[model samples]
Target: MSDANKKAIRTAIQTGIGVAAALPMIVAASGVPAALPWVAGALAVAGGVARVMALPVVQALLPSWLRTDSSASRR
Candidate 1:
């Protein structure tokens, strides 16, 4: 509904898609021993969350010169 909520949902869906794509490779490369895939999946989800959460912090830390805005207000 709101922009913040929409952004969060978009981030989560993108992360889920990434995990879905990577999980099979992780399982195949590591050779699943029943619990290993589950463990890897958990770790992947955690990492994805951390990454998404860090985005705003990273943007804040970046120099203004390095940031870009396409809004008319920026012109």
Candidate 2:
């Protein structure tokens, strides 16, 4: 697939992950009960994503805009 397509997929995945991580916190902070389970699930998902992101192959998939090096060639 093209770089732009890959970048869009990556962005959408990360946005979903961000929303998943935030939902539990928002619920808990709002004084909702039974949020512990949701928090635990979100934590697990975040941890798994973090580990996957640390992989060299996964890092290679990251968009240039999201890279720490910030040295992408300009056209």
Candidate 3:
């Protein structure tokens, strides 16, 4: 696969893992019903996909000082 595609998949997986790990704590802190956590997990996955797809645009919009160098180049 192309580098860009690989990067996107990596980002999506990382984001999903982060969201899944945080969901329980978030739900517990808010004292919301248990069923709502499933909805939150779904939203997190959607948001992760959207963010991965938009990453290039986001990087372009950020100022140079705020942007990190591509770590993939170091691999």
Clashing pairs in 2: none
Give, for candidate 2, the lowest lDDT window spanning 10 residues: 66-75
Model 2 alpha-carbon miss at residue 64, Å = 2.7
* TM-scores for every candidate against the unseen true structure: 0.41, 0.47, 0.44
lDDT for 37 in candidate 3 is: 65
What is the C-alpha lDDT profile of model 3 across 1-75, one tens digit per residue? Answer: 999999999899777767665766776787887667676666566667556544765555555654444532233
Candidate 1 residue-wise lDDT, 1-75, digit = tens: 899999999899777756655665666687665366667667677567656534655545545564333232243
Better of 1 and 2 by TM-score: 2
Clashing pairs in 3: none
Q: Mark the regions of model 1 whose C-alpha exceeds 4 Å error after superposition.
A: 33-75
Ten residues in a row with the worst lDDT in model 3?
66-75
List candidate 3 stretches off by more than 4 Å. Answer: 35-75
Per-residue C-alpha lDDT of model 2 across residues 1-75, encoded as one tens digit per residue:
999999999899879867755765766687766447876677677667666666666556667666443333131
